[model samples]
Target chain A: MLRKLTVLAAAVGLAFVATSALAASTKEEPVAPSAPWSFDGPFGTYDQAQLQRGYKVYREVCSSCHSMNLLAFRNLGDKGGPFWDPKYKSSVENGYVKAIAKDYQIADIDRDTGDAIKRPGTPADHFVAPFANEAAARASNGGALPPDMSLLARAREGGPDYIYSIVTGYHPAPAGLTVPAGKFYNPYMQGDLSSFWKGDPNKVPVGGFIAMPPPLADGKVSFDDKSPSDLKAEARDVSAFLMWAADPKMEERKQTGLAVMIFLLVFSGILYASYRTLWRNIDHH
Target chain B: MTAHTTYEPKTAIERWLDTRLPIVRLGAEVLEFPTPKNLNYWWTFGGILSFCLATQIVTGIVLAMHYQAGGASAFLSVEQGIMRDVNYGWLIRGIHANGASMFFIAVYIHMFRGMYYGSYKAPRELLWLLGCVIYLLMMATAFMGYVLPWGQMSFWGAKVITNLLGAFPIIGKPITTLLWGGFAVDDPTLNRFFSLHYLLPFLIAAVVALHIWALHVPGNNNPTGVEVKSKADTVPFHPYYTVKDGFAIGVFLILFAVFIFYEPDALGHADNFIAANPLVTPAHIVPEWYFLPFYAILRAIPDKLSGVIAMFGAIAMLFALPWLNTSKVKSMRYRPTSKVYFLVFVVVCLILGWCGAQLPDDAVIPALGKTGINLIDSDLNSYVWLSRIATAYYFAYFLLITPILGLRETPLPVPDSISKPVLAGEAAKKD
Candidate 1:
């Protein structure tokens, strides 16, 4: 069996080398290394404090342009989420979700008057869009549409790492390279043709350019608990928060995984015992 | 089938039922069927596969309850409604998505076990063929399921694969059009895919019944590749194999749950979270991992028509397997050279899968650095050529190696009975 495994490994290794040799010549988008995530491994859980800080970063910075349209204000109070309130049940009457919702104004029509009206947000309302419509968003952002932040972490290749890299990867174009107007050099963003800002032979990042400028800066948003207020720290926090937003059921899932695995293992042990006893004396042909 | 005590209806109700339909008798026969005592853990995969099928069906029916199949709403429905709003919807959707992968994983193990043990040979030919039919349906069901998500990969993968049918001579164009339900993959295509996806699993279930019936006709072939000659060589399926299969399923479910809960999206492509946009295509549009081996075979050939033929032919080749290998020995374990070849075949298939996942234009491995010696074009990478070689080996393993190895290589000494090794304590050594 060992010999068989060795032979199989050698065959696969040879094939991998032969094929990868060819794949080396073609230039593809560079995949950024994933930063260590709090919820990465089986036993991992989100640091609630960090998630809250990250949510702050998103609210103050990212929400200006990007929309988290799929998220309800009520989602903030769910367990495993950043703003979960233990005291709050399903109803959000006086909970933190209600408080958070009050920070933004939501647009709705007045049922009695039959006219458009602006009102304070509640837990039921989705995150308010910065712009009224797609056309307005495009007009404001130099024709590039800002993607929704709700599933941004999952939608991108490297998840949280990709978001962090893009947010912090901005650099000046190298010598002999021209910066196209309205585009900034960021190696990680998947933008249009001009976004491929590999202008500087010396400084061009793997991916070309990005339309969204550096959205994070040092000390941009002060943390209540006084975690690091640097650009990298902010990027990491927001990315983590986005990841939680993308899959809020992660904590429940990991807990369920632990219980299920333990149950199965015990069940298997019982079955094995029964198997041994059943076959103990049946040894003839 | 191995001889067993015929079912005797003890109770009045059982007797009446037995006289009317014999359903109870059939159930009793299945439960008490004589299975070879020497059958190993590999045999447990059939039960595991059945559990996966039932899981997929149950979870799929629930997912469909909330799943919106229309083009405009399908993507949002999955990402928002199914994943977010519905109670425990995330868990159900996660299980369904990952369950497809689990199902394929079990099926592959089952098929390979059959191959290694020569379970496809002789009287089990129809059984093996029925398995192939089930596999074909599974691929179709999985493909259609992937498309219903309406993501970038979903749209592009559906388009790329559906267009492959156009490579056919005269009937290809119409078939492709009919499949799409229009000039392009639109709302109509999504609806039809949803309908067929719901329908094919039941067909697979029906065929699985036939597969089992065929297996019962000849009973099971033991790992020793020898037929059972007496009652001592066999055991009742109820208490022994049942407990064993149940334990194996527990193990399988544990692994499945790890993926379902901890890393549900790990097996999935991240790009799938993005809604389907016909205007934008991903840099590399690849099928799900299970389809990669066949996908590699498809791309191994450059011509569209030939690639299409080769892809389908790869699956069709399995149906001819019982006749292709002329070996009299039933198990690869007894055929030393054939065992080595079998290992090589498994490796080649894995490499083919890895190749399929890679971008065709990218280099798989870098050219030997600064050798100043170039084999072909300095610009051309080795990935395509390696894929071709692996693809050739995949076919040759079935077409040439099996028959030739049977005639050429000497096999190990054969045990006359399944109980011989166990009685002599050699079975423990094998384990």
Candidate 2:
């Protein structure tokens, strides 16, 4: 009888343990992580000239389908400008302008017709999406909405490196590699046949393989009195411009961080000296 | 230093591990003996819960390495991780994704153990309250984390939850805008949520430390519903409880590993696979399964504002449980009548969870006409009446039965000794 009771007690104890264990299992689901790419250290900072060229690439080609609606026209004239030089602010203002009506409605109009109503071209304007509606947009672009490019440089898995790689890394299809209809493949994407020919498979560019067709062509847009630049350089420059657009304050943030650190160090030294004097008499007591 | 000439380890690796993980031997020391004489297995949950938390933190850090914060790329970044990049990025992502479900699973068990053992009674009330705060923070963190993916479910879930704020009085619209960071849930909202979601877990860890600290002060309540009276009744936590907790944690990990490796997406919504769209809404909107009971409470009310308030109120009411249940008795083992009611309460909660998952039309009508509760104007009358009945029963279990049972019900005569109870019943019959 004693043995039976002991067995029963043990069984009940095991059951409770099992139930509790099962309950703990419920809490084990993993949360997805945010922002995998490292923006710090050695690989940081894009070249300024590359950014200037990338801006031109954007203006000439990618801007047709994508919108930088979050950016102000005047912002292009700031020091280390993402789009244009400081002297060209007036020209940029004259080139594209937004007019607000009496009732706070913003209208973009033709420069020729002073009274003509127009869509907004200001930083505050909602982006003019590529498609009119979901159905129409999908129908036009093989079911993929050409996403807004305003934050694309910062938003993808690889940050700026991904954008740079995708733009400059496109190549002609290798022998025996079949391209899917309406889908343009980038050779630098991992797992693609051209990925092997591009060099070591281990070093494919960031943001993984892309399906967007190549946007730049040799001498597609040219600047007069140019001091030797290739289409690849132009592509790299445009990507840098997009990166600045995505995070205009990044450089300023780094500078501010350094200033704060210096101030903290100086303040700590003063405080430490004050503490030493204040505690000096206490030790003798 | 003068008396003892100790030889230092020459290797850098030895020095590092020795300093950082000095408790390795201590961990083994704790895992070697018998637990307190009266300690039932309910004590095992706290250790298991800690194990799950560690898993989440580790996996969360790895996932953060690849995640993108912006609206445009957040969804696609996850897809890239699954399709390319990093050797076992997919496995890591899957484990982290499923680890959330496992974390909640452990907490619920930890919570229910507290409830069943009356761990929340008397001195432990503050501990339970801290636990409730932890639960609330965890829910917020999970909800915000889900939005980072920017999938169909993420978009709609944000919309639905944010819109709930609009049900408030005059200031509702402004509050909703403030919460969304704009006219609608957009880039600003995503950025801010990412920042907060990243921050809240650290806060949760801090609160959990307090929760455990509170538990230690009163020590642990046991199954006998009696306080420790002597040295014979109690045991030191190490050696005895450590081994028991270790064994329980091992079993828990096996189940967690199964979900991580085999059926990673089993608990997730399929709609989340699609990228977010503002214009389109999915056919159904359901919250994570762990939230189903409260979700049911929300839908149970016919009015939008009332429904919102009622759902929140259900959770808030748990705070008053210690004062409301004037039960002298701690465990259900002693209270015969209350035991049956507690079982029924569990069943009701399960039913509510099931109903929460189904379409509103499929909610059980409770045989309304036969019950003679007249439905004069609307079909909603039936639902309202049924919900009121269920809600009444739920409250009554706490307020009336608990206090009444404590005052009036005849409790089973408790054994004087823990071992005696086990030996008394069966041993006599065998003789």
Candidate 3:
């Protein structure tokens, strides 16, 4: 009976942790529900089909506001990238990537005229910004700056999970909660809503007001593969794409990690055996 | 000295060089040095630390080649140029970043192992002091290294940590100004930090050589804390310790590799990915996990000057440990009471690290969190009070517990020599 009671107590404690963690952002910020991403564990690799769909979400929806200044057209076809092909050893030489690069206009200097000109982008060109500068972007978006998406997946605590959660986490403001002008309620966001809350003093609600309204909706970006294009799907795809942008070397890192781990383990075994053999003649506890 | 001199130069060329340098003889002496047979796995950390230092130096040199120290470009150089554009730059950068954390892990264990075995006592006091100097140099190196990326955390962390000197009266402001090279943490500060970060590692290497020299003078402290009375109590440094330390290092490298590859950013802050913006500040700013205990101690006191003093005092406690511990019995193995206290001290330090990461005003027990029973400004059940309690215990463990326990506690009867326990067990088995 005592053991059963202990087990019951443990279960109760674990349940309490789960509910409290997900229910509200007390001082502990709300944890994003982890999505099953293709790239998560040590052996995990990015799903190319999903990444391709993800690029569509970024280009069609997210690109109008957010910028991926660090990403180049060549990067889209680099080894382990979405458009990568074994046939094209160099990402710049990939025909698909070249075509994609040619679709966009890149800001360039006209060599002869020495004047700024917009020309067809090459594979080497970086992704262009939606707005010319931070001020212009802020002015266009209700005096709130849209953060660059180049490293956004990495900048947040939960990475892609946090991005997915925020994009899909919008909810109707609780009756007692007050949202400031041009702000939307997101349960996944981190903030203190005590002043804005008219609810019970003990219950100030989870999450905070975000400047960006819900950007993802059902059928937001129709995928080429005819995959699901719901709010969650779009959010998940875009989050994955951003993750690729943030950590392009993850595949190589993981692969090298496996080799290093194996070598270390085998080397350790040899060393341990040698240590045992060397100490055999001695008697030191 | 039954063995003949193995390193006596036989060749004419070797004999000609031996009188002038004899570096080969130095190696021979080091490899053949007598070490305590009973030294445990804890002794392996010194070897592991040597490896850690070498890893940091090599990886750091490569990272410096590619890293741009300018404030505006530092983040880009790291995130885009190195991580993406440069070949295998991600691997190099990850190893260097994670290597710092690994170095601290090994050093902390090595230091605590010293404390538990009372390796800091008697003739080894200077040795302990040298080790302390190396630790100080490591922290300085790490702090400056963290500032090089010029990210949000890098900028603000540098700003906050440098401002710590300003807690001192009179000379504080000037020192802070001199350190920053400007009124704020900007490009100039980044440049200077990059230079110093490169410089401090070499200084750590120098101090490490001295640390080893000091160690060679006294030899290693054993688990029994009994001084070597005979040759039977010791073993040669080669084959015995070499293989043992090598095995331990292999194990340490596994952990280091896991962090570098699979979990590269696990030890780092996400805020560091964002470029430094002077106008914007992160909601909650905390130091790296390694510095959390000191951070906790700093915040435990309400007054800024007192907090700063208390934080530095935490490290000063380490230097004063050998003198403060009054026990004739060195190792905690003999002192059961001290063993318990030592365990508590370890836990207290961990609790202090947790406290550092948390908001001071947050409730210690979440159930009683915002009760508003303000005991001197904040809630009675808050982390602030918990931290204060932990800080008090942290000091008391060193200042009060060690001296008092040494005098009062009846310790277990210790063996006369390192080999006594081993021989006694063998004798009992024979009977």
Please give the CA lDDT of all the candidate structures.
0.82, 0.62, 0.86
Q: What is the lDDT, from 0 to 100, of the residue B399 in candidate 1?
A: 96
Q: Which candidate is the best by lDDT?
A: 3
TM-score of chain B of 1: 0.96
Evaluate candidate 3 and give its CAPRI docking class based on DockQ. Answer: acceptable
Please give, for residues B236-322, the per-residue lDDT of candidate 3 as tens digits. Answer: 889789998898888778778878888787777888999899999987777777788899899999899999999999999999999
lDDT tens digits by residue: candidate 1, A84-126: 8677667355378888898888888999998999899998989
DockQ scores of the candidates: 0.40, 0.02, 0.39
Positional deviation of B154 in candidate 3, in angstroms? Answer: 0.9
Q: What is the lDDT of residue B352 in candidate 2?
A: 59
TM-score of 3: 0.94
Candidate 1's docking class is acceptable
Q: After superposition, how far is residue A51 of candidate 3 from its true place, in Å?
A: 0.7
> Would you give me the overall lDDT of model 3?
0.86
Winner of 1 and 2 under TM-score? 1
For candidate 2, lDDT tens digit of each residue in B336-372? 7878877787666655555566555432554543344
